[model samples]
Target: MNKKVLERHEVPVADTWDLESIFSNDEQWEQVAQQFKERVSEIDEFRGRLDESSNILFRALSKQLELEEQLGKLFTYAHMRHDQDTGNSYYAALQDQAYGLMSILEQKTAFVTPELLAMDPKVLDALVNEKDELQAFAHMFDQLKKQRDHVLSEKEEELLARAKEALLASSQAFGALNNADLEFPTIKGEDGKEVQITHGRFVSLLQSKNREVRKAAFEAVYATYESYKNTFAATLSGQVKGDIFQAQSRKYNSAREAALSETHIPLSVYDQLVETVDEHLPLLHRYVRLRKKCLEVDELHMYDLYTPIVKDVDFSVTYEEAKQKVIEAVGPLGEEYVNRLKKGFDDRWVDVQENKGKRSGAYSSGAYGTKPFILMNWQDDVDNLFTLAHEFGHSLHSDYTRSSQPYVYGDYTIFVAEVASTLNEALLHHHFIETLDDKEKKLYILNYFLEGFRGTVFRQTMFAEFEQLIHAKVEAGGSLTADELTREYYDLNVKYYGEDMVIDKEIGYEWARIPHFYYNFYVFQYATGYSAAAALSKQILEEGQPAVDRFLSFLKTGSSEYPIDMLKKAGVDMTTAEPIKQAMQLFEQTLDQMEELLEN
Candidate 1:
């Protein structure tokens, strides 16, 4: 039976993360915020003096970084507190205040970049050579110089900056509608109990062994989205339009180009992922066939995709057991790494229970000055165990990066961020399969691994393809009405999942509900990151200490280099199709093992 979700206050103190480290209390936070507001003019003082001397430039940069760090701390705290219970008006107001202050800060410091860009390249280079402190910003300046064509005049830049809030209106509206207003109907569960569908509960219901329950839950959730299809389509269309407008305003050819250029990733990498995954569609079809056979079903519907084919395995894992298992699983990373994991586990770094009004999913989040904290609605199951390990991966990555690099480079890019988290999940899976001796248990574990690969690599690649296609359509002046979006999505589903499975028409409305589509070409990184993690995990398992050293170096490097360069140091080249191909091969190998185990 499913347990009742608790209120945030009802959750045990030890089960919650300690946010006091950010500020002693809300009073202190308010004081700091007020002081920051009073000192906002400090950065404005360096307005036109950037070209005067290297020391002046260094001082200005230092002040800006210092203020940014403080703002990060304030904003991170406010946002996380708000996420704890979004209905809390106090934290909501605090979050809004922080956002407003951040916007004002941006406006106040708007002249720094354009002023720096106004200087001659030779003059800037000479200034860098004049002071040792200025050397840290060499890459920053180089990247700015590269954007010389895109950077507009001072007034234009300010106008664009002011337009950011307006441009984000669509995304903000979607979030408000989806999270705060939209509600799914209550549906009968496997036990014939009425359960209100929520984002958190939907996953568990989809994986139910009861086909009736799964179908009911699936229909109920999408039905809500279908009712508001026009609204969702409008929001998504507005978002895509915003991307196109921003790209054109900055003189880029397309939205995809502008998005990828931010991370310095080549357009070829995105194209290659879709192409290689397309080549492997037959493998996915084969797996679907296997799934159909394993479940002894005549027809496999989209709702059946998440159900476990292997049953009665008792794959329960408690939070305590998960903690020890994660430590042991990551033991190959050396004592220091394992010790840090243990520290985070004991230091109340995780908020470990689901509660009413809490955020639906899980994530690792913190500022540079605070502990790397993780928020989870943890379940005592294998999936939650892997999630625990996954979040720890992010926390540990943050821990290492913040400790090793300066605040300016403390945080890693989202592209490389998933590599560490997914790598941890991969390592935890390996540990389970090797250490568990029971045949049925091993089969369950293997199934879990395959399901993860399918969701991360295959499923996310499908999303990537859809996102790219929609952007192209918008760029080409095509309409993206609800009907058009649904047709395109359904066709892509058929192409990716093959002819064996029934591509349920309702699943096409799936695009109307995904939060990531609003993220503007960001979903592709999940597939790419998983592929990189797969290759890196293989190395760590086979090559031992040397590979671990390289992976550790990757964690510490942070944003000091480009994301692609950082992954290259860890020995994974995402530009080529090798990593995706290798990940596909591993998926096939796992399928083979599952087939053999079932045959025996």
Candidate 2:
């Protein structure tokens, strides 16, 4: 019999995260929350007086950071509490209260930016030089200055801020239609039992060993998307147009430029990724050809891509085993790094199992002052083991950054966010491949690594390319009608997957299901991050202490340096194509190993 998910209270105390460390109890949270709300007005006192003196400005910014840090802890605790048991009404209310407090804080601090912009540059420079406290925020002020050309007047800024909700209408409508209203067809499972398709179950269904089940699930999903093609097209077009409008309003040359400018990433980095990956398309094609051979199918289709090229091999790893494996896997990072990871494991920094109404996926979450905690709805599988290592990658990154940098620079940007996580995964992959003696088990691990690389690097690069094309098309006075969107997406798939795999007609509707298209050129980071991680992981393994120290330095630098520069410090120059090339070399090496193993 399958085990029943436990109630929140019934979950063992040791297995749960020590959230009481955040606040001894709910009553204390309530008391702190009230104090936080009362202090919201404290920011308004510095509103008009920001230009008074450097010391005053320094204290105002410092005070703002202090309040923000408090708000972060408050929201983090409330959301984690609610996530642990979504059915609990009290925590739900607390989460809502935290959100409300956040809005108030934002509203009160809205004047700080415009007021700073209004100050004389010479005066601000003098102030910054005058105060030692102000000097710490020198990088932050420089970043703000870069926005001087883009920023509008106080009145105009307010107008744009107020229009934020209206701007999100198209994306929100797509979410409602795609998530709330769409109905998927029921199909027979591997056991010949009828199972209804869901967004969550769709990917697993495609991974089914039964080819017929995979094909049916694929068709059913695309058919639903096909029915709503025109509507989806409209929503997507609106979202793209809104992005362009926002970009033009801010004087950015294009939506892509505007999106990338936030993280100081150069357009060449993105272009180089596409160019390098395009040059290495044969590597992916070779993998697809291998898949065709391994499956021994008459023909390969897009739907067949997700199923394991290697059949079942027992790789079950209990949570305890996963923890130990993770610690061992990261051993190359040095004793200090391993010991920090051990502290996280021992100090109850992870919530390790699923219970009724808990969150479905896993993540690392916490504020600067609190322990960086991980949440998991874990299972006894290789995937869970990798996930444990992946999340600890993030938690340790957070731990290092918080301990090293001030609160203002504690959190890193999203561009470099995945590097540490994916690097950990790379390390774990290496650990498994080196340690496993059984060929079948090693093959399973090899297939897992290839699938991850395919999804992260190849697939996401394709997405980034498509995002660029769509925005450029719309900017050049073209409409993204259903037919246009479908044709472009289909052609791109043909280019990326090569002629070995048959591109299905329904695959044109695949773009409709991706919500990231609305994310304003954000998907490229996945491709870039994975490439950096692969390269950095290789460096750490081959070069030992020097590479590991550089990688650790990148983690601790946080937002103090530009993301591109941070990766450079870690010995991966994302500006050049070397990282992507290095990653491609790894993929080719792995493919060669897998083919040799199967042949032997």
Candidate 3:
């Protein structure tokens, strides 16, 4: 029976996150709201005075930063409240108001760019060199110059901004449909009771030991989606076209280039990961064959892929237990790092569970003034224990950045964010394996690392490659008919999974269900980050304090440096194949170990 009543959910303590720390009461937030309105209106006070001199520019910029910090606090607190319980209309309404206010604020701030652009570049450069505070804005200002061509004429920029709501309709529509409207087929639990299906529950269902339960859940949920796939595909195609239109209008070579260039990520990073993963496809094939042999099944279908090959071993670490376990796992990270981590968890730095209508999945979030908090839907199981460690890794990273760096460099890019989180998982796996003498426990850990590679590295790369192909097709004026999309996705699956497994037709429709496809070229980072992290984790384990210091330094960086350079400092050079090669070697080693254990 579900512990949650209509008003709230009973997520495990570790699964619960703390948002109350942001604002203890609605009255406190309300006071900030009044102050925010007053401060926001003051933004125009220095507008006409901005061009007077370098001091004038700094003054106006200072005002903008003040407003930003206030607004960031306003919105983060409200959004976190809403995420805790979407059914709570008080917080939900507060969130919407904050968001609408933020949208206006964003448009208001757009003038900052045009205003800065209006300044003489030489004068601005001199100011940056002269003033420490002004130096912080230099990266943002230079980034604006890189986007000058895309900025449009003042009148045209306003026109485009005015059309933003209409232009974003397709992506917004996808969100509403997927999150609010689209129906999912219900699944039967082991108790023979029906349960509402969800994205979070979908993976849980696949891990069910009962084959009938797994098959019913898999087919039922997707079948509901299959019926409305054409609609989903239409919305998705519109989003793709929107991306291509934006990229082309900006005079970029492709959507991929436009997106990656913003982060200044090397195009070779994308290409090299695809190339390396493809080169190593046979090893994946071998893993699949081993899965078949161990399961004693002559054929493996896509649905059959998720079930574990080794015997189940329970590792139900409680919230308190997980806290200690993760600290022990990263003890090599040094005393100072571990102590800060302890402080973060002890303080209300996490919001850990799913309440009614709460958002799906997990993330670490905060503003400059607040604690970096994590949100989760933690179950009382081994996987949830790992998720606890993973998110804490992110929280600790954010904490370090906020504490050590100025607000200007407080937030890191998504590219490096995943690296920090996944590294914790790798460390926790190592820690668990070293402590457990039981072979079953060892195999369980091995299975997790194996699945991690398959899901993060192998599968995300496939999605990245597919995303590139379809976008190119769209750019070439070719329409992506549902049949063609399926065939292409299916063919790619066959090539990746190899001849060792049966390629289910339903697996082709999997593309229609994946939400990440809408994220343009974002999926590749998951694969790259995971591989880089595996190598970095190995370095931290083997090299001790120097590597640990370098890794922690990477977290402290935030946006102070570009992602590639920051990661390079952390000892994983992602531009080449060595990190990926090392990661694959570890995967192979784990696979060999698992196979030997099963044989014995």
Better of 1 and 2 by TM-score: 1
When superposed on Cα atoms, how far off is each prediction in RMSD?
1.5, 3.3, 2.8
lDDT of 1 by residue, 299-354 (tens): 99999998888976677788999899999999888899999999998899999888
Best by lDDT: 1
Q: Residues 290-362, candidate 3, lDDT per residue (tens digit)?
A: 8888777777878777766665555555667877888888787889888988887778676654555666677
Sorting all predicted structures by lDDT, with the top scorer first, yields 1, 2, 3
Report lDDT per candidate: 0.88, 0.87, 0.78
Write down the TM-score for model 2.
0.89
Q: Model 2 clash pairs? A: none
lDDT of 2: 0.87
Give the higher-TM-score candidate: 2 or 3. Answer: 3
